[model samples]
Target: MDSISSRIQEVTPSLTLAVTNQAKAMLARGEEVYGLAGGEPEVDTPDHIKAAAMLAIQEGKTKYTAAGGIPELRSALSEKFAADNNLEYAANQICVTAGAKMACFNAILAVVEEGDEVIIPTPYWVSYPEMVRIAGGKPVLVETKESNGWKMTAEQFEDAMTPATKMVILNSPGNPTGAIYTEQELRDIGEVALSEDIVILSDEIYEKLVYGENKHVSIASLSKDLYDLTITVNGFSKAYSMTGWRLGYTAAPKPLAEAIEKIQNHSVSNATSFCQYGAVAALKGNQGFISDLRDEYDVKRQFVLSRLKAINNIRVVEPKGAFYFFVYTGQLGLKSMNLTDKLLSRYKVAAVPGIAFGYDEGIRLSYCTTLDVLNEGLTRFEQFCREH
Candidate 1:
């Protein structure tokens, strides 16, 4: 008999983590490996944020507070939502988790029941489907066209809906593909969700990283109906370069917030006590760090875009937000896994296989590293394409 529960058996490990681990292993062996597989920014957390955490420790704030989060952090986030996203979420209606990832999982587990369906667009974040499956729900994948900038349309969402459909996940400045949904586009989709009373899990973790004319609009802020049906998830990982801090929060209606809080109560208990203070500092302290980070990412994005355009047999859409490029590598005559394997093994550049994001024709490359690393990595990548 199988020792593991069937639920645990059904989940697939994260391919992105696997690739990154292999790259780290190569580097440990004193090998020169260009790592572009990581999802977080390659920067240190702001000094003020670190100071806040240290101060908390100095003040003896190590004990566990409420499972959701400290009142100060939640209240600060409440103000942040009002000021940044134009959404009103009372402190009681927010639940802070270990990371934005936990916030998403708690939200999923709070609403998704056995045999329920959750709609996720293609080229989704690697963890979405796994999270849904972990909650005993079915993940309905809708294939989005690269021509449409890898965004799911209202019509496509409506067509995929069934009686079992309970939620739809939207990641603006999406991972793998940095597709930002416009306000009008969100309104169209919101209308359908409202009619069906379907919940919307809006992941805006990369909201502050957006560039050019693209704006990050929270679907929950579009209208009252959409607001009632949405769960907004954000964190300090990407924006504040605090990935190791493991701070993220979810703002939903009171009932959903309470349910997610209950889940947190039984699991990790709460986000690190001192880290909550750091997150509070992130929200209330200097806002200039965000704009500076966005500017740097934008510069790197443009540099990578130009280099990829100069190479043959690969096509990439210029990302409007976020630091990733979902490069089409189908013309190289290999699926994403094999392509990435050869790229890593032969060319010594590490990148994530597109199949991990449900797009086998492409691979995902992050420009979060230094420009020198990106330059050398892209050079080797160009050679790989030429030989193929």
Candidate 2:
């Protein structure tokens, strides 16, 4: 008899993927799907980035270059960290991985040990705790209040600490909720992490998608000490609409960076070669497409927010970044899975169950599709809520 490893067995398959795949299957069967469950931008990759990748292929730059990343791309990332986030990292201090998801997993695997605790706030991106578990670390989830905009307070961070606490994961302009941590709030959390000597894994993949007066702040940039304690993870997937490109990176203190690179060396080796060239182009080329996409998302976000507000029996805090809304469906008197199942099966709308994000009272809806789909999906969703 064969058996799966306990670590792998303990992990739950990503429900976000499950929902998206189901929606895709329905669409494949010629059923109309609103397709509000995906986490990717529904746009073509910018032409210049594609041209750069094609150029790399033409130049035969397709062979494996480095486990961490190609030097040129890493150097480009070094400048990106400085110019965009106000954090300084030499090329050697960065490790490029297959995607931001892998960058996160590599950082966790490098540091977390058995019995160590990793604090994760509630309504987090569904992957964080699972990554910690795979690394043999206990994920200590601290429930955050909805009234506080679903953000964990610094006091809450300190309260969650134990002698066994080894790390804390922070996602800003976060997934599911789209909550952006303010600069002062980051300072307060940094102070707590500093006092406890906890490693910070800051996921800022949604950094470039913020709206209005809200700005994305890298927690590592708050202070030198915080920078030393942080492994900042970011990627091109969200910002550049390059999800299929499979590129992202981690910038850490020297030792931590070395360990993450070692893990990368043993695992998926390197991100795709020509894609690295594309990422370089994504970094160095024209940035207007990002703003244009953001402007479109902002319009969809407002339309969804207004529609959700008009619906009875649900509540939603406005998301200032990223492209999702974690709408509270508690008053509809169904758990997220049930609500989402009914929405998909009966109303032809697909959404991620918020239970996947550790919040059973809500469901996450992505506004990454066209306004026409948004209008139709929200109309059906409103009908579903009313009947329930």
Q: Which stretches of candidate 1 lie over 4 Å from their true place?
A: none
What would the per-residue lDDT of candidate 1 be over residues 45-115, giving only the tens digit for each residue?
Answer: 99999999999999999999899899999999999999989999999999999999999999999999999
TM-score of each: 0.99, 0.99
Runs off by more than 4 Å, candidate 2: none
In model 2, the worst 10-residue window by lDDT is: 1-10
List of clashing residue pairs for candidate 2: none
| Model 2 agreement with the true structure over 231-296: per-residue lDDT tens digits | 999999989999999888999999999999999988888999999999999999989999999999
Report residue 317 deviation for candidate 2 (angstroms).
Answer: 0.3
Model 2 gets an lDDT of: 0.94
Model 1: lDDT of residue 85: 94
